[model samples]
Target: MDIFEKVKEIVSEKLHISPERITLESNFKKDFEADSIDLFELVMTMEEAFDVELDDDAVVGIETVADVVHYLQEKM
Candidate 1:
């Protein structure tokens, strides 16, 4: 699967939401009501899934699904 698809899968599983509910513009906090711990787990899961180490600085700027896709795109 592509980055977004992979991300959607991870987010769906992590948040216990449907993949159809996720979009690039969906905000983790606003849309999913995800707290810091949720974000942290998502980050850690993404790291393992994508096989990349996400720095704190980079992760801080990630608010939407698009941000994660972009970051992974740039990193890969």
Candidate 2:
């Protein structure tokens, strides 16, 4: 799968949401009810899945799945 699909899968698994419900417009707080720990776990999960450690700047700016995809694509 492509980066976007992989990201969606990660988010879906982490957040316990359907892939259809996760969109570019989906907000983690407002839409998914994800708390701070959820985001933290997501970061660690993404790091494991992609086999890359995130820097402070990359971790701080990720506000959406698209941001994660862009960050991973850049790193890869």
Candidate 3:
């Protein structure tokens, strides 16, 4: 799967949402209704899935799925 699709899987599993509800433009809080704890797990899951180290500053700017994909592409 592509980066975005992988990300959608991660988020969908964490948020317990259907995959169809996730979109590139979907916001974590607004669209997925993720709590702060959920975001924490999501970040860690993304880091592990991508096999990359994510800094606190990097996590701070990650507000959407597209943002995570773009950042992961850059890291790769």
Residue runs of model 3 more than 4 Å from their true location after superposition: none
lDDT of 2 by residue, 1-76 (tens): 8878888998999999999988866777778998889989988988898988888777877787777888999888
lDDT of each: 0.97, 0.85, 0.88
Q: What's the candidate order when arranged by decreasing lDDT?
A: 1, 3, 2
Q: Which prediction has more favorable lDDT, 1 or 2?
A: 1
* TM-score winner: 1
TM for every model, in the order presented, reads: 0.98, 0.88, 0.93
Candidate 1 regions exceeding 4 Å error are none
The prediction achieving the highest lDDT against the true structure is 1
Tens-digit lDDT track for model 3 on 1-76? 9999999999999899999988888889888778789989999998899999888898888788888888899998
Which stretches of candidate 2 lie above 4 Å from their native place? Answer: none
Candidate 2: worst 10 consecutive residues by lDDT?
Answer: 57-66
lDDT string, candidate 1, 1-76, tens digits: 8999999999999999899999999999999999999999999999999999999999998999999999999888
Look at candidate 2 and give me any clashing residue pairs: none
Candidate 2 vs candidate 3: which has greater TM-score? 3
